[model samples]
Target: MFNGKFLTPCFKSKQPWKRLLSTQPSVVLAMSGGVDSSVSAALLKQQGYKVQGVYMRNWDSLDEVGHCTSKADWEDVQKVCSILDIECSQVDFVKEYWNNVFEKTLTDYAQGVTPNPDIGCNSFIKFGSLLDKIPEGTWFATGHYCRTNNGKLLRGLERNKDQSYYLSTVPEAALRRTLFPLGEIESKVKVKQLATDFGLLDIAKKKESMGICFVGQKRKFASFLQEYIDQPPGPVIDLDSGKVIGQHEGLYGYTIGQASRICHGSHKWFVADKLLDQNKLVCVAGSNHPALFSDTLVAKNWTWIHHQIPTLPVQVDAQVRYRQSPEKAILSQTPDGQYALRFTHPIRAIARGQQVVVWDQDWCLGGGVIDAVL
Candidate 1:
């Protein structure tokens, strides 16, 4: 039920990866009871490598209402560990999750930003805390559809499976020790076939995760942080007329370029920007105007994978959301000491504070938090 078709915006992925097993990589597999990691562990084992499957004790509260908790994923990991016949362990990242990923995400939301938690999860927990448990020579691995070239980050296998965009912020040190076994393999369909070939359970048949991994679907965002997040009601202003159209429950609850959940939908509205100073939602009714969207965007917090940043601004493509194509753009350094990227074609709803990943061909140059639009 969870894997049923839902609203998927455009995402960028690699064409498929080829991982040679010559190294006999000793890896720590991050298992989520899903197909991707299941197959990754299976492949590592088939190649005669030492593999360990570890289920993350995520930050979701044990007392959280509804389907968000430890029981389901825990049981699934246990079952998968038995099937894979690999060493399995559990690690509690609740404290680190709250401090590093959760707070940073909610804080960005409060500032009228849509921060990607996967970025934080990779940089902090999965690669940070989970990797710490493995031995010195062992590499950390995941179920993600991404790849690396000579320890440098690249697009993963399956053009539809690329996840490098979410990892723009991952440090180079981590990339050196990271492995994506599923990066070059076929889709989950083939992964399922391989599972059957190996006498393993049907991991792909299990429902895919929707929304936040720890937070189950349709649960109010506020409930996750009753102690930390505060929802502040604000006015929804008309962008063209500059008049108030409706009242929003909280400025922090919405993201730039969102179309759903508008209080007043009699007239179509798109979030142009978040007016945090005024605590208002600045929205446009009909967005036929080119000026409303962006062709060039500047992202802060820039980091490159395995390569020094170019002194000259590089020509590349970028994506504002997951599953989106990397739009053609030119990169430049602004006077403010941050990077600026002007796209070949203007992209719709280029929200400030959302993620912007830049790619030079299949090689990942880097990405940053969007700070301005033009």
Candidate 2:
């Protein structure tokens, strides 16, 4: 159970549950057996909406032992649905996820670019594949920490837990039907308490999922990557002194800004860049190295949630990665239709292939894939 911190629930009116039983719309919730999605189902039930819970099995045994963790998750989903007295269903999206998400992820790393599979999974699997599979006329919901106002995507009330960045590239039409029951909750701790209050003690205490999508908690991602791609040892070069300082297992094993894995002494080194053509890994001494900072970046495959690109040179808050605060920047499209972002101050370790999500106050303006750091 979450540490006790009381906050008023989203529905302030008395007997909100009564209305849902009468005429409220029915919704199909994508339950992942996590606390956030659990609370979503409880809230929908509380609001009197006829709810059906669907757990997506996106990864199977072929992914690696204990990688999927679907068994435990499905058990939780069943428990939650039973408590709520709702029907639960499971779908196998293993083929779709492998082709659309997992394959592209390996391809990105092999090319020396770090990609965000979570972002792609939200677009292609959760919203794309699942939505297509659900029966027609069924409204959808998920545990995503984002808001939709008038068919537009908005940042969740909780700044730290806002998941708008991942959902930024999802189809606008998907946003139109999807509901985030936890959108207005300001804290994850509060969500846990809400679950506890609703008698979902197990889910309230469930640990958060991290690293690559579908991978079990505490699994080493670098080791997992090796299963698919060869990590050939290569020289780690110093960007400033232009000398070979150490050797890396492979360029694929490291990411920009990652602590230098080859360093063995008091001096610390960090990944600054990669030379894919020459098969070299570039490292710079110290965390404050100028080589790690960039004020400009080029992002391709721009996806604007509103389905319209913003005018040139508009100022907004740009987030290069999840959990990082959005920095002030000017966003504009390149002549070739890709987008560029120039931060008011230099940002550090802007990795290629990561998403650069933008926002105008509370509204998520959508984002594009980072093509280069200039």
Candidate 3:
């Protein structure tokens, strides 16, 4: 179920995209065997576009006893392609995923930041390596829930399912040639209904994927990180009283603003901050603890959709994570070219290494990694 989910902390784009579709342009569709991609492929083929399905075999082994769902997903991909009467091919990108996404993710975790691997997968793997497999001059399409307006990226029809945040890192060039057949669709339920109406019942019934992409949906993030990053127990300290309250599995095992597993009986504790150098997790008694909110945040690795960063102090709405409602903010460029977002209200747990995508109304202006909070 590889759509636009797994991502890493740092990424940059170099590809330039131009869309020169012929009367019957050939399209290489990333078919993840899910209903979204299946419906996308079917729709593209029906639209008189030459469509071919590409199933990426991304992760073969994950730490000796670990494996991914690529095998099962490939079976579904083949079935959909067969049903659609489109030629399907497989590409092995295990090495590419390991190098570009997984390694950076582990490094970010080690640095005490909860990074988005889905962003890295979209930037480096889907839009980067996969471009190499596609024949030159062919259009690349995906099932992502976003639209492009004359090369400018825009929100999908369904705001709840919009994926422009995960795709903020894709180079403008590649995006110019990208096709999102399901972009205008209103809802996931509607997409599934379309699939069933198109005779793709199995695809419509497939469960939507969650969590990490290559890793199974049920895999615990802490358990997964334990496999790569050392699982040293660290002290969980109360931020209010500066007292050692409990123990954490590891500093990297926690993310800011998330509920603490170290139960506080009747009271609740939320991770407020991580002291990486000291290997300590700071927890606050409540979810709305003052320590959990920040009005200002500094971000790095800025990548604009159209390669344009508006003048400093530009008013825009920003999102620290997917599915989060965009918050009004003043966007400015630090002297170092990093972005500074001063939200109208303090946001809860703006974690370093998470991408903060800025939007002008419905258009995604750009995105960057949160580097600091003020």
Candidate 4:
């Protein structure tokens, strides 16, 4: 199944993989049949590492229209591995994903909180169960756009695509054993170009995957979630006037800072908060409503990359969401033992259950879940 022409581009000195030494470490790369992971396998193989591709099936349920991409994705993985001449395998993690990530995510959503399943999947599945399934001495690798140095997670060189935030919850032990081949690449454009040069043009042209895998792009999130969550409709109230302006399918359908689709008025309305106890969806009149921003928030269950909490009241750059510009903030411990992140300037939509990743410049110190927005 090997293509001699496909292997030629990987050896070019100008390729980003050229920086890697010929260490030949045994590596198990998480291949997702996307351009990123496919390129990761190629880079690892080119670096002289003994690489094996493993496709993880995390979600098994079919979409509302009775469709799933797992089969197609596996086909792509096989094609990519064939071109690279590497042994490829598949593993099912559906049970583990449900127990560790999806279950907790649904629970959070049911309570009007927005939990980030990607962070949980990285910590529990990708670096957790997947690591256990691999050979004992094999180094784990993935297509994540983040860097590591001396066991510390760092931002990807491509700032816009930096995924250090999503990986903040991963343990230091996992960080040490993980390899990120795409970390040093200048941009996603370069990655696609590299894929084409590597003779995997079909995979290179694939659209980037987004959102939760189980929720497939074809279905509405609310509709997909309705199947799993018994979301009773609730009132969408205006924060300023305290008026019941519209009705919402459920609190899970809205997140802090999102525009209120159900509300209609001369001015656009944004979700300001969710009064979970009262089962209310609060809205503000304008997109830039003062109620939509907050300067302080509390984050609990903090995961420090070094496994040690830093000095209290430490100043760091923090991000409440992925791809957001980092903001200057102070992280200090609260009386309740939770960490409080106070931004120098007000940040918009600091939602509960969302991750707040902190960075010491480019080094990802770690992160925690948003417990309270103040």
The TM-scores, one per candidate, come to: 0.87, 0.91, 0.91, 0.92
| TM-score comparison, 1 vs 4, better candidate | 4
Lowest lDDT 10-residue stretch of candidate 3 = 8-17
Q: Write the per-residue lDDT of candidate 3 for residues 1-374, one digit (tens) a residue.
A: 12222222111211212223457788888878789999999999999987777777778765333456677788888788777777766777888999999999999999888799999999998899887556666889999999998778899998899999999988778888899998999998899999998889988998887756655566777877787788589898998789998899988888899998887657799999999888889999888889899999999998988867577789998999996999999999889888899999989888999999988998898799999999
Candidate 1, which segments miss by more than 4 Å at Cα?
1-25, 60-65, 220-227, 263-266, 287-292
Highest lDDT against the true fold, candidate: 4
Candidate 2, overall lDDT?
0.83
Q: Put down candidate 1 lDDT per residue, 1-374, tens digits, no spaces.
A: 01111111111201111122456666777888777788788888887777766677765554356666365776777677677666665656778888998879878877777788888888788877766655666777887888877757888867777888877777778888888888887576787787677666556577677667556655766566444667677788887788888887777776667663565657777777777888888887655544367787778887776666766677787888877977887888888878888888888888777788877788787778888877
Q: Please, what are the lDDT tens digits per residue for candidate 2 over residues 93-129?
A: 8888999999999999999999999988889988988
Clashing pairs in 2: 20-48
The TM-score, computed over Cα atoms with residue i paired to residue i, of candidate 2 is 0.91
Local lDDT at 256 for model 4? 89
> lDDT of candidate 3 vs native?
0.83
Model 3: runs farther than 4 Å from truth?
1-23, 62-67
lDDT of 4 by residue, 258-346 (tens): 88886477878899988878889999888888988899999999888986667889999999999689999999999988899999999
**Count: clashes, candidate 4:** 0
